[model samples]
Target chain A: MEFEMKIDYYSGDPGEFIKVIEEKCTGCGQCAKFCTRDVWEADGKIYRPINLKDCVECGACWNICTADAIIFGDPKGGTGVRFTHG
Target chain B: MTEDNFFDVIVVGAGCAGPAAAKKTAELGLKTLLIEKSPEPGTKTISGTCINLAGMHNEDLYYILKGPIEREIHSMRTYHINDARTTVFNEIPTKGVLLLSIRRDIFDAWHTEQAKLAGAEVKLSTTVTDIIEENDYVCGVITDSGEEFRCKVLIDAAGVNSIVGRNAGLIPKRSGDNMILYVTVAVELGEEVINDRFSDEQGGYCIEYYLAPGIQYKTWPWIFPKKDTVTLGTGGYMTKDLFNDKITNVNQYMQNFLNLPIVKRKLEGGKIVSWGLHLEYDEKISQKVKNGLILTGEAGGFVIPFLGEGMSPAFATGIFAAKTAAEAIQKNNFSKESMSSMYEDMIEEDLFLQGFMHVGKINKESILKKSEEEISNMMQSVVLGGGFITNAVHTKWLEGAENGDIEKVQEALDFLEFIQPYRQIGSEFEEIYRKLRAEGGS
Candidate 1:
């Protein structure tokens, strides 16, 4: 049997949320690995966001990246994971 | 920014610790400013099942959170996958000391409001980018918006990220091995379903700790019930390879935990509501206080290692840091000598240090070597002794003495014997023994 998992992802206006500096990215893939939201994907050579819309802006990718490649800021107001029962 | 931007004390990161520190500082009539990187307090906070409020008093910062206490935990059960059996430890005499369970987001937001009511100026969505130093003393901070805020003293309460502490050279960076990764999902199951499954009628909760083989970490998985939701999570020590393998793919671990028969049975119809990851410092590191600065909460590695609880320690240390900051301002002495004595010396005497010492003694390998009965006995004693000491005696200790490993039983007996004197000294240790005896143990 499979358990159903639902995640609400929020993004702000263009150029407002997470940004990966390609030059600084050394293909470490730490951002792709550490994020639980599956926001980043690895292409075997480097890492890129496959679902940037899924980013909750938790900043885990920004903090875990050693090469200082990812930039993460809070999304615009009322744009992130909304906890209904928390 | 002008000279008017200066304050008597500036606190960074308005989580559990920062707001508490700011509240205390402001209540003391200091010009205090609390800054948070998240859009609001609790926005970035993630916690496990429930917080153990053993050491907290009525005057604590936790009480200020004002979140509805979901349950008062009176018992805890540990499940061993090898035997598929459970050991139950119930507090005696109706209900003994209890723990409070509340949602982290709600609790934190309420705490931030408490800080505001205490007269601290709070700035949301403000990130402290760097620590401004002069002659090796951190006297100010530079925010992300190119604004500088100077202060006589800075409190670093930035949780496990340790942003200000690491940047200012006050604390070391946590490595993977020393960090524990927690991937949690809060599932809404409705209060009726939760009450039926846990057999809790008075809003009491149960904590189930799972120990499965092949897991590198000593403490593996846990299922905790809140008011209307259940928090399911798995935590393990982060090894370099594990970081590259399992730690990176935490959802797989969560999936495995959910697939367990014990978990699957209880959460059969729950709907996942939220998902998040939190990093905690599981090992102790030194140098939490420097000239003109103090570190509280996870930034200071204040979380207990074995249980992985940080709320009480964070709140306690927050208040302690604020008190020390107030003294430094009153005496007009921000030197490392004075600040270290005021903060570090006091923290060394706190319960977090004592708990850290106790957890450090029980090596994971040694625990893994013990028989099931021995492990159960030790865990029972741990809970009864408030997880800080191992002096409580149980009938299982006597049974193990006859049927189990002689050396292990002798070790447990030796520790109990060592504290026998304190049991008669009419102190707190005596109270613990009295409770143990009342619980039909000893």
Candidate 2:
């Protein structure tokens, strides 16, 4: 059987991240709508990331949090690409 | 005596975007000149409220904004009228916070000073008559005062109705109809008192409310709390019918809604201050730089959809254009390739271009196919009103809720489709809801 590649990096799943405080959620869905990650779904009233590995730690969810439920940890240094031309 | 005219770059419009670009260029050791049509920056510029950070293309200038911001909004409350309910939202993307209402005039003055400190020469009250062209390349800009400033690159941050962009032949004479947005009124109010009275979740700050609705057209009122004063205004989609007296003149249309019980309650002894119009344009993205000319800010049609807020994008564009111009001078190359790198930089930022495209698609479709009422219904149903349903259904009881009816599912899916394009940045919307429910904020 082909092996599934594991992303060893410590990127938190926005889905599980939101689930930590799922019951307290009023389901305004603002987080889901504004998230650059496509992490939350309003229809299901749930937060699940399609791929937790892709999060760049932009901290958008943390800023948008009125409830302050989302948490973020530091990523490994020199892990991402910086657009010098940008 | 004629000055040496040693400027390497001349930027028009000292608004937030213009001055920011000038400051960046100056900081990079480029001889920069910033020009403004008004007595100062943001004097003539008009926008409803503070800028959003999701569209920020330059991170350096984003940090600079921290010093001038009036307040940061971590959450928003959207009222659903038909349902007579309100949905409170906590999650806003981390890109940046909603502006603490600020006086564009004051903020712009500070920005101009920053640019000056960075070594840019700023000439206020200077209006552009035309752009000087050598062959197809824009060489300099001519002011109405019979003066000409020569530079290798001409950056246009001239606000939404940009005469420089049109004159430079960078943008077309006629552009497509995204939405006919016409805003009138710039009423000023006492900031502290207004914020104390009106601001709810984010201090005395900016608040937007829906007054009336339709699919393609809608109108809303805003109370933006600034440093010394507040900007209270209203606007809607521009169509022939909105101006017709049979329905309502623009002024009456606004007054009728503002006088409502809920809205009027907030303005119980308030005064009607100054008023102005914000004529907006929605255009397809094109190469903002051609030859030696570049376009920045709203003049480049960088405003956001759903809310039409663009100050941050404008500022970001300014920074990009100035840096690009500086790079060209450093390399001694001002070709289309050299100058257009800034435009490429902005486009490459997924948020900037993707946001632009998302709003573009929604607006084009809304104006072309949907009626004003339909657009309103969609906004009310999916965004404003729907938010309430989402929050309430998840937290409390829906009274007569059913599991999974195909028809209900289809209707819900259709509603989601209506708001798919305008959904916020990373889809953190649902996360906010989940967190709220888990925390039991009832």
Which candidate ranks first by DockQ, i.e. highest?
1
lDDT of 2 by residue, B1-442 (tens): 1455647888888776788888888888888898876554554654635655445434565444444555544445444343354333333333434444555656777778889988999887566767888987888877755688888888888765566876665544321243344433443345566656545553424455553432113444555555444455554444434444333434454565455556566555555444444445555547677888888877787766445566666777777787788778877878887778656765555455454545444444443455655544554554544442242232212222455455545544444454455454453633443344355421
Model 1 scores what on Cα lDDT? Answer: 0.68
Per-prediction DockQ: 0.27, 0.01
Model 1 Cα lDDT, one tens digit per residue, B3-71: 679999999887778988999999999999998876656756667346564555324543442444565
**For candidate 1, what is the TM-score?**
0.78
How far off is residue B376 in model 2, in Å? Answer: 4.3
What is the i-RMS of every prediction? 3.9, 24.1
Worst 10 residues of 2 chain B by lDDT: B391-400
